[model samples]
Target: MARVLMYTTAICPYCVNAKKLLAQKGVSVEEIRVDQNPQLRTEMMQKSGQRTVPQIWIGELHVGGFTDLWALDKQGKLDGLLQNN
Candidate 1:
């Protein structure tokens, strides 16, 4: 298993859905709530180049938002990324 980091806001539906999907996949995540932390939000944007609520990183791979994450899972690439080989 790899380290999962997610930059998320409190009221984002996509963030909730992303977390649920990750839970279903049995992946433990470290969530950073950027809604209250401006610095983290800025860091997330700088790191991912996306001004989005859910900025997910499976190890060093930027997995993008909820839709992108789901696409990876559907393509069966998410698990491999999570394994971080």
Candidate 2:
């Protein structure tokens, strides 16, 4: 399984859905609460080039957010990503 990291807020619906989906895929996410730390949010933006809650990374691969994740899953690409790392 790949190491999953997510930049998230305390109360985000997309984050919640993203977590739920990752869980359903049998992934345990390392969640960084950007809402609690502004610096982390800045880091997430710098890392992903996207200022959004639930910026996810599978190992070194930036997976964007919930919609991008869902799209990957739909394309049957997510499992391959997880398996690679």
What TM-score should be assigned to candidate 2? Answer: 0.97
The residue-by-residue lDDT of candidate 1 on 1-85, one tens digit each, is 8889999988999999999999988898899999898999899989999998799988888889999999999999988887773
What lDDT score goes with residue 82 in model 2?
89
Global CA lDDT computed for model 2: 0.94
Among residues 3 or more apart in sequence or in different chains, the pairs in candidate 1 whose N, CA or C atoms overlap within 3 Å are none
TM-score of each: 0.93, 0.97
| Candidate 2 pairs with clashing backbones | none
Candidate 1 structure, TM-score to reference: 0.93
State each model's CA lDDT, in order.
Answer: 0.90, 0.94
Q: Which residues of candidate 1, in runs, are more than 4 Å off?
A: none
